[model samples]
Target: MFCPHKNSYLQLVCAVNPRIINKAVDQAMQREHFDPHTELPPAQRLESMQPSLYAPHVDITRAQLGFGRIGLRLINRALHSHDNLVQLQALHSVLDQVQISENAMFLINLQLIYRIIDLMLDQDPIIKEKVCLILSRLATYYQGRRRIMSRPVIVENLMRLIMRDRKEIRYAASYTLKTLARDRCACKIIMQNEQVVEDLLKMVKSDHTGIVVLHLATLTNLAEWDLTRALKANAFQIMLTLFENKDPRIVSGAMNCMSQLCKHDVGKVLADDYDLTFVLRRFLKSSQIEVIISATGLMCYTTLTTRSKWRAKESCNELTKLLVNLCCTPNLPLLQIRCMQVLINLCDSPDIRHHMKVYWEKKVKTINVRTHEEWDGTSETSSYGLETAHNYRTMCIEKVETIKNDFGDNAQVVNVHSYLRRIREVKEHLLQAINWKSYKN
Candidate 1:
């Protein structure tokens, strides 16, 4: 007798016999049988069905009855299966269709996603690849991305794939990490994730550009989280070193991360201990606008934080010139803010102030270039006959400048500048945010 679990596992492989696979796929497509109001089936019975057969039915049951308790029970049972093939098949089936219900099966889906991930520790390379695919699928699902990293096993498995594998599984694992970081809890887990960091550093040193670049992107995304101190420091150092990679893509990814991290105190720490300036300067000359923009952003951060140290010792006029060039882009508001804020902080000196004044005038001119109709369009309309007070909410621009000065003589100027600039830029961007011009006319 053929095993249903084995057949389900085969469903994921194109190499499997088409007839047998199609037959199993057909069974999986059948209508589900379960009730939303009823409790799940006993564990043993649910475990008896193939994941391929049970996954669809569970999803269908949940959709029809607004519950998937039976499906969850079956998934839990499959999780306990001793056969690796059976477990892999179960993982494949569970991930095939999107889960739309918030019932108990949702819990089972989370549990099963972890269980498959647990298989990454298996000694078999094939099994490890299967686990990588499972995690990738989980991360790819819009719903699943939020919860995927909550289970430490998910990150653990992805790290394992990154560390021990050389195939596409490694890339998939990194992509999964990038996805998981979209969730705040997941980002914290990655920030404190020691083993993952060690594996990532090793991957960065590998000859494979794809693996290293994607991993760096994931790391940069992780920097968005409020990470613990020691882990944050370690990650900052590793990523700073990656800025030297010859591959422009790898350099860009590393620079993207540096641009963000350099906005934090830890960024100053890295520059003090590493050759952060040289790295940024070299990458700024990249042929790609994206690479140049990222490199310039990081330079803006470094210039803000390390300016005093550099100005006291060596001339930083070239850096300021490069920043001015970067600030000229009208479309790159974030970049312009970072570069402008850095320039403003550095402008306290008379010499730098003269240079910055020109850019400020440029910005002022751009700010006022609105069409009369566009300007009048947002003018508040008075509904009442009597004088109505229009509360025009205006930004306190001087208060921000004061705060920039308030950070004190030794304040992390780059971070301070970035903080103030980010707030204003966020508001500006939101105001200019797209309602899709097609609809907003």
Candidate 2:
């Protein structure tokens, strides 16, 4: 077996008393008749664990002990003690070990998962706050997430805690939920639980940016799966109202949620009614890159339809130029790509197409060397997909045309001339591949 005494992760736990640490672990190992990983059977199980109605497997073993199983076992026993100081020490020790996968499995084997969750109900707010933090840290791993999701009491407890007056604990509980909400299954659970949704929505007036961000982020995750509850909960207006908050974090979170909320027709209708395009347009100038990116995402929705495109234009005359500015920086690939997509959508409106061809290209075409978005017509199911399927013919035409236009052109040309040539080549191939002359003639 690996020596726990030498491993750095175990130093804090062993520091309490090296002898005690070894004794707990040695006693566990000496029980040769029992599997250290498995717990007592139904009738003989701890009353607390049996009530959970599920047999929790703790993966503690000699191999994983180096990850801090000894500390976890001691902490588990100490948490059940009536003494507050002992519980606090155990909780602090857990903070160090719970981050490890092996520690989480040991925690389950010790049947300590239920007790940690139960600790959330402790009358002392500090204990409850620490409990929420432990849960939060536990949730950052796959093993921890699996264990947490298995306990239904967690969601209810967190929801109730968010409603309480203790700000620190409320934020911690919401923080734990924010981590859980990132998982698809967790999103489903939150959406299905009407009380959870209601509780999150009621926290709309929270002054704490941390709690607000967590709640909004959690709701945003749920909205991505289904916009129904977001619609029913009035998420559109709630996000808009929260946008007025001075905190960029809060505004960005709301904008992200707004992006998902507007994916459905009903949500879009509400956005249009509220003149959201103007609001988004105003945020385009935000100093925070996060707010700008979120605004750009929401702006895409505004160009999804004929009416919305004009509305987007009305709110900001330099929509294409502003979008091009976002594309100027390749450092933010997502923002750059999203800005280009918004330009593509805006080009759906005939008048805006000229702005894209002239202003957009002049401003940022070099930033985007090649694109699949400028009408590839790759859809074969379009009823007439064969018109541009001849690749060899198009390539031959492209080379022939470039050679003809190259007339005195040399590799010595400046970067600008070369850049313009590339742009011209893209447009020429785009038209040639589609057999532009055949259709026009």
Candidate 3:
């Protein structure tokens, strides 16, 4: 039975029954009688998996031989005890077991989840701290996230606590919610609470860089679905302020959030009004790879207009060199692909095209042209291969020709736009060439 007042999915998700949900929640969390390792083969069809899909990942037979079962049972009992000390110790013990991941899996149940949610509002600061800690630990696991995200009370409380709680509690609560925010379904539930969205936007401006980073990470998730919520919250201005901070993490976080926010015409108008193109250009010089990637991603959208294009052309020398360097670097094919994309987008201006030609003639930068033929293991190839960057040089060369040959002296962007399609096609073909399935497996 569902709550009568809550008709929509958001209301349904955020609506909690306090003590328990219907029998469905109980049935979903029920433990299988047999060992999961023995019963369920590893899910080979990885692409078909849903966000909240729970796969039995442990060997219960081995777990029963060890103290894993007993430890979890004791923690569960202690958390339900009348004494506060017992509850505190049990919460701490949960934190320890959660590090092993599988042990944490044993501890998640409907009763304990709601009980912990209730305990989260305890008057004792220490108890509140422990409650947040336990929740944070539980939230790290897939099973824990599914349960916690299902109950939107945790999201509301975490946002409230982050604003009013002490440093440690705030951090703990932020960690839990940020972990849960990884689920898009959970993020939609969060968007339903306008106050929670506003609180996150407010928290992103916290003086504490660590707090700012965690909250910004959470905001990034919220931005993926409800960009308008953040846009109306004047998140763009807050992001610009955050970009002024010297901490690479803060700047990168702001840039990443802005990357999502700039998806719409409204966000783009804000960027043009705030001069975000100039803001991101400075970050291209950052030594941090994350900062560079985030800045470049923002650039992908921000540089779409004639004004931003002209602005970017002002620094086309540095842009060209950076794009060229990134494309030549093996093992960083993903970054290379992004670099190629930005480079192609930059070509919308003939001034930039002429500038690139003049700069290339003065200093022709090249890499191992055969980088496509072999994996150098130079740029973190363990997770990816150089396949995508195989034709990277060729793409750049064709781009050069597109710019120079399409409309030599008085080239129209209309023709160049048609020419740029081939570059994107190459990117698409090279993207498919990547053995992403093998890498993920």
| Clashes (candidate 3) | 0
Name the better of 1 and 2 by TM-score. 2
User: By TM-score, highest first, what's the ranking?
Assistant: 2, 3, 1
Judging by lDDT against the true structure, name the best candidate: 2
Question: Which tens-of-lDDT digit does each residue in 1-441 have in candidate 1?
Answer: 223234354444445544454345555777365322122332224543443222222322211122346655565567568865566555554444333344323643556655665666776554565556555555645456555655666666677677766656677677667667655666776766666655665677763777777777676666656433424447676666676666767777777766666667766666656756665665555666556756656765675654454551244556666665766654444455555555555554555555444434354234422222332212222222222322121112234456668776554333333443554664354223211122344
For residues 76-166, could you state the per-residue lDDT of candidate 2 as single tens digits? 8878889676676677677667776777667766766788998998886767877888888877766777778888778988888999747
| lDDT by residue (tens digit), candidate 3, 129-245 | 767777777765667777877787877788778989877678778887787776777788777775987887777776477888888888888888888888898888888888889
> Which pairs of residues clash in candidate 3, taking residues 3 or more apart in a chain or in different chains?
none
Worst 10 residues of 3 by lDDT: 53-62
Worst 10 residues of 1 by lDDT: 388-397
Name model 3 segments beyond 4 Å from true: 1-71, 361-441
The better candidate by lDDT, 1 or 2, is: 2
Candidate number with the higher TM-score (1 or 3) = 3
